[model samples]
Target chain A: MPYSSTIAGTRYTFPDLRTLLACASPPRAGDRLAGLAAETAEERVAARMALADLPLKIFLEEPLIPYEQDEVTRLIMDTHDAAAFAPVASMSVGAFRDYLLSDAATTESLRDLAPGLTPEMAAAVSKLMRNQDLIAVAKKISVVTRFRTTIGLPGRLSVRLQPNHPTDDLGGIGASILDGLLYGCGDACIGINPATDSAARVMALLQSIEDLRLRFSIPIQSCVLSHVTTTLDVIAKGAPVDLVFQSIAGSEAANRAFGVDLALLDEAHAAVQNLGRGPDGANLMYFETGQGAALSAEAHHGVDQQTMEARAYAVARRYHPLLVNTVVGFIGPEYLYDGKEIIRAGLEDHFCGKLLGLPMGVDVCYTNHAEADQDDMDNLLTLLGVAGCTYIMGVPGADDIMLGYQSTSYHDALYIRSVLGLKPAPEFEDWLTAMGIMDAAARIRPVTGETQKLLAALP
Target chain B: MTSAPPDDDPFAFLRAKTKARVALGRCGDGLPTTRLLEFQRDHARARDAVHAALDVPVLSAELVATGLPVPIIVQSLAPDRATFLQRPDLGRRLEESSSAKLEKGDYDVSLVLADGLSATAAQKQGAALCALIGKSLSFRCAPPVIACGARVALGDEIAARLGAHLVIVLIGERPGLSSTQSLGAYITFAPKPGVTWDAERNCVSNIGPEGLPLAEAARRIVAMTALAFGIGATGTMLKEDDALAMLEGPGNSSPIDGHRDLQG
Candidate 1:
């Protein structure tokens, strides 16, 4: 059905739900590049006005991408919990936004409502929300997952110690890892984006990380962010694989562009489970998503990048991932354009992922070519911290030499944790305290005898 | 556990291990003033590198002096840097006026030097590398084309127009804080505009002083080019590992070594 709204005596009409959602979305370079954004500012507000009055059931009745054509659509339709949705089944999108912000949407209630919410529903309501609303609603929703350490706990934040190296040199990666450990980081996981996709190289990096974990007896998990196929090959060779990593997209075609699919993810999940790597919990997947992935691949099916991004969360939640983060600004200026667009995308991803019952984190980052700097990252980092984001990246000094981008640093993590009174995961906190790296108040102590031993142990 | 003396800087040794900014001293959970300024300084350089224009005349003089053909200057469909940064699709096609400059000819290879994201990289390294590869290839080499507001894929259209069998793009890589002037080379076989994908091209990145040096980068590029010609393919079908033995055999002293300290 077509939708229309009149504002300031000017009428704006959208032909379908997908077009309505696209036109209603805030300005982003990706949408504009794709020619999907609203042509005028007034038309955008008009589209939003029309979208606000949309019945929540309209999303169920009219699919954006047809159910038969897209497996992601099929998955959402097949798994939706009608019973959980009954409470707000009749509400409009704007009314649902009000409901989410009202006193009724407590932590437990949002958790129960998660299965009932579709990616479209979450996305539609998000367009109406300001940054504060996104934060306020997300802070109330607690989506916890576990592997080696508990993540997404209230009053806690985590950091993925990203010790990426240009050549995948073991010594360089080890040094960065040690640097992160001394700052009481790496509770979420110690992940590496290897320079090469060779299975042998991935195995060697995994073995080195596993060795460090064992030597320190650190309560942490390790992942080599490689292709799922390469990681599966490594796992079959009896390597210590803690988490299976993949870059997934919202559409079937886009996932195909990434050389991944649901069946492949399922196979990798089972393969990791067969290894029995995670004793703490069964959440074994670590997914990295960004808004512009589908569009960049020319497989977005005319959907806006943000809505496409939210749909990726559905794919992530199916495997019950331990970590799912949006590399918001990594795609460059083509998608996000600048700091403002990047910050909004980060908050939206965190809120959408958390609302859909996944441990969402933000790689508060930017490429040098993009119109963003460390100050913008600091703003998003503090905001995500306020929204109780599950985790953020802890690159060495926020400079990822291998990846050629700037992300939140270990010191940035410390700054957020200190100001927000957030603690690391409980198991990791205990390990830090025992190692004398972090004090009781969650402040990283001056590197002393214990940390020096860590530094000395690096090979 | 034995405590190290406070006077000794424990992290000093780690600085040599990787280019990653690690062991930066902290002042109460934030970067110390000196470290913070250092980061800001590096970031400023990187941001500036993205906007810095290519000195075409100087680069052309260097190429000509190195016994390379006088360059054909061109611009992509993107009119300016802002449009180039925001609209990558536009940067892949040749502007009409630039496209008209090429006449179809049976050249073995087309060399394109593009000011991609960081013109500083292309200006620093583009000429000498082009001369080295062009002179060594033992085949007919097209005049080098210097592209403004270009992306890597711009080489495809330029090469297709020249009727070259292979296209090698020596372009500026995205500036990172550690190295603002790093160049990258992308090689594609049987180049065709709008038909080629990024996966169809093999890339050799991080060509700078601190990363892969000029002689090694030239060796790999030539090896990959030869391999692509031999296999009739590039990208995923062509593996760099196949050329590894050739890379290990010998080192040719590069004429491009003098440009390494330009950033300093």
Candidate 2:
């Protein structure tokens, strides 16, 4: 059914729900590139006005990408807990937004409401929120998961020590890992994006990091961010796999473009759980998602990038992932355009993911081609810190030499932790103090004799 | 309780192993001034590399000096830097006028020098690497095509137009803070326009002084081409490990030895 709204004297009409969502989305280059954005600012406001009045139940009635064609849509519809949605069943999208922001939306309420909220409903309500609203609500809810250590607890922020290397050289990767460990980072995990995706290379990298973890007896998990298929192959060959990682997308078609499906994810998830490497090991997947992923793959099916991104969170929540982050600015300027768009998209993804009951993190990064710099990253980093982000990448100096992008540095994590009074995962923090890398006050202490012993152990 | 001596470089051993910016002493949870400025400077260079235009005439002359045919200059559908950056699809197809410049010919390899993302890489490394690979390859090489506002996939369309068996695109990679002018090579067998997926191409990346040197990169590309021919495939089906073994064979020179010969 066509939706219409009036502003001043002009009547604006949307042909469908997808069109309404696209038009109502805050200005983003990806939506414009898809030729789905509102032509004028007034048209956008009109669409938003119309979307605000939309009944929350309309989303269930009108499947955005046809339930039969997209398994993601099917997943959303099939798995929705109607019992949990009963409180807000009769509310409009606008009222839902208000409900989320009000004091009544306590931690327990939001936790219960997660199963009831569809990705579309979450995306629609988020469209009506400001950045602060996104942050304030996200801060109220926490999604904790356990692998080697507990993550997403309140007053804690973890850093994925991304010690990526250009050649997958053991020495180079080990060096970066040591550097990250010294900065009191790597509580979330020590993940590496291998330069090559060869199965042999993936196995070698997995063994190398596992060796480090064992040698130091550190309470950490390690993952090689290779294709899920390659990771599965390594696991079959008896490699020490910790977290099964994959780059996931919102739409079924987009996920297909990435050479993944829900079935493949389920297979990988089961394989990793079988190893049972970490403590509990219940959360065994690490997923990286971003805006424009569906559009970039030419599989968005006319929906906006933001909504598609929220749907990705739906896929993530199904797997009970330990870590899921949006590599926000890594897709470049074509999708995000500038720092403002990147910052907003990061907030939105975090908000949606957290609301959908997932341990959400942000890569908080940008490519050189994008119109962003360290300062832009700084702004987003601080905002995500305030939003109760689960983790951020701790690259060498905010520079990923292999991936050719800038992410949060080890020091940047230190900065956020200092300002926000956030500690690392409890177990990892204990390890840091025991190793003399961090003081009791949660500050990185100056290099001492222990630092020398740590350096001597490097191969 | 005592801190290490001030002059001792605690991270020096690790720093020697990787190019990653690690272990610069921090100032109260922030980067010290020297390290911060260094980051900003490298970032600025990388940003400039992305926007900088290729010196086509100089690159063309350099290619010609290496005994290759005169280079054909062309532009992708994207008219300018901003458009090229914004519209990647436009960069994957040639401009109408530019497409009209090439004549259909049967060739073993269609080489493309593209100003992808970083024109600085194309300008600095394209000609030299082209010379090395052209000298080594036993196959018939067409005159190199210099593409402006180009993406890696543009080579597919160009090679398809020329009826070449394979396309090897030496394009500028996205600039990183540590290296602004690194070149990348994409090799695709059985070139097809608008039909090929990125998975159908094999990529060799991080080609520069600090990373993979030109001589070593050329050796690998030549080896990969041979393996692709052997298997009648290029992409995921062609194993790079086979190419590495071929390069390490008794007769083949080491990468360092090849570099020395090139310098001499």
Candidate 3:
């Protein structure tokens, strides 16, 4: 039928079709299609004039797919099968928003026609998504099942215990970890970077923290921030490896220099997938990264530093890490020369990683030689808090002995939580309340008898 | 005539004039991205320099190639890198086997090559520097010794064991991002373990391609050793001003001249 009124070059006789096309992709021949389509050119030209005269219509017609919550689940399953969650998982924030708010919008139909939509084959379709997309899908798909139960959900923040020591001395390192836990910090994980890069030493340190977790019944995950291969070895040796740790960079060469690859990462992820640690089951890995790593490895291939950093996240999301931190100022002043540069990089990394659906944290640190200080870190941490950073590193007095630098202190984490009115992860918050080490407001209170007993019991 | 006046553009001026991190032009907010990446690259280089394992056999071969006899390889009391980092006191003394391997000899100067914080620095500058100094001055020089996991203090025992009147320690300096392979020379007269304090030592620092050039560093080391011999002392009792003034004449300044002027 010849029509003058048009939406996306598809002519329609009635004025309302424009609203329908804009809001709901392609409107089908409805209960009233014949009225909307004109068979005559005169009626079509008349419809265009009438459309101009008509009031602006808000496309509040039926949602793209009319379904109840369970019906949405079923359609999603029917279209993508067991992998329905893959649809919105790896989409950029803008892309996800476009999918949701588009004319073809509605959760179910978007899932059905998503970039990585799945179908059963042999008469059905097979779904193979990018690893990061699969991980992101896991988070979104998990909403219905809610399989994972750790941090980085809405309105929740977590804190990591970084009792780094130069000698890996159990007593000295334990004191720092105990201090962090007492101050309401170990919700995310208690991870250590041992000074000696010996696999045996890393294994011993991991076992020591595991012992403490058992003794205190502290329900937080633990990791040794060694190479993922080393962690895999320790795991093979029958150590309790809750999360495999590695330093990841943006490019393939950078990852190789850091002694990791997609294959190694997958193996690490699968290694811990069934451990079932943490409150929400096991998160398989923890990743640390910084900008300029790709450039350091001579593998950036001329990409901008921040873009390289985001690509690193694509590698990280595969493992579903409990914590993924950008050691913002740790690499020294050569990459991020001053406070302004460091602060900007930290924010950019946080924003990009979060949009890509990873649990993001900033080290909020600097070296002695850098043109930066505590005030710069304060500003960065507050900004990250506002931007919903998942967790941060907590060291004694913000000093890291092994790394030869300063980072966010336990007090800084407390201050950020108080200022932003954010709480630690729910499971950790419950433990803190029961231990009487923290008040309901997430403030540090005097250690009660029970808490003191737990602290004193540590050897 | 005065040298050409400084370049009108401050960035080019600073960059051409000095290796110091300065006048690195900024972009919208921070350092230009290229400069920032360069900084990171240099930082990684510096870190690699520091953690680098000293290849004793290769260093000895290089030393021998420079016409000096193959260096006697030894190690400090620290067993490994981890111990060396935590126990500085241990790196100042010789291991038992190294001490047993040492026997007294008559010599005017004992040259000791040590891998301080940066093996890269020591490896690059040590042998060539030793040849330069050895050829420039006539002295009863002992066969040079290569020490792994060594600190400046280790030079004393090596010299004392050789019965040399002077000890010149060619060691690695803690690397900065800009110059990871810069070497440092420490000269002491009347060498003895636990006898010389930092106040009793003379230092020539930043010896590399970017800092003091190799030839100049060798000349300065020879000059300092001569001065220590001419006088009865070294360290604070000896200063580089006289030598620098004589070497460059008036109004000629080195790259680190500003720092020297400040110290003065």
Which candidate has the highest TM-score of all?
A: 1
- TM-score against native, each model: 0.94, 0.90, 0.51
Second chain alone, TM-score for each candidate: 0.87, 0.87, 0.82
> Considering summed lDDT, which 10 consecutive residues are worst modelled in model 1 chain A?
A273-282
Model 2 interface CAPRI class: acceptable
Ranking by DockQ: 1, 2, 3
Give lDDT tens digits, candidate 3, residues A1-459.
121445446555433433222121111111011122244544444443433332211111221122242222233234333354444445432354334345554334543433133111100000112223322332231111011236776566678888876567776677777767877888888888876666788878888888887776777878888777777787778777777789987666678878777788888888777566544655667899987676656565443355456657767766667778999887654456668778767765765565445677889987643556677888888877776677898876565655656688776777788888888888778888888977876776754677766666544
Tens-digit per-residue lDDT, A1-459, candidate 1: 789999878778999999999999999999999999999999999999999998998889988889989999888899999999999999999999999999999999999999999999999999999999999999999988888899999999999999998778989999899999998889999999987788999999999988888988999999999999999999999889999999999999999998999999999999998888787466999999999999988999999999999999989999999999999999989999999999999999999999999999999999888999988998999999999999999999898877778899999999999999999999999999999998887788987887889899778
- The clash numbers for all candidates, in the given order, read 0, 0, 11
**Model 3, range B132-182, lDDT digits (tens) per residue?**
887886789988899898888898988888888998888887665456677
**Which candidate number would show the highest DockQ if scored against the true structure?**
1
Candidate 3 lDDT score at position A269: 82
Evaluated at residue A322, the lDDT of candidate 3 is: 71
DockQ of 1: 0.48
Select the stronger candidate by TM-score from 1 and 2. Answer: 1
TM-score of chain B of 3: 0.82
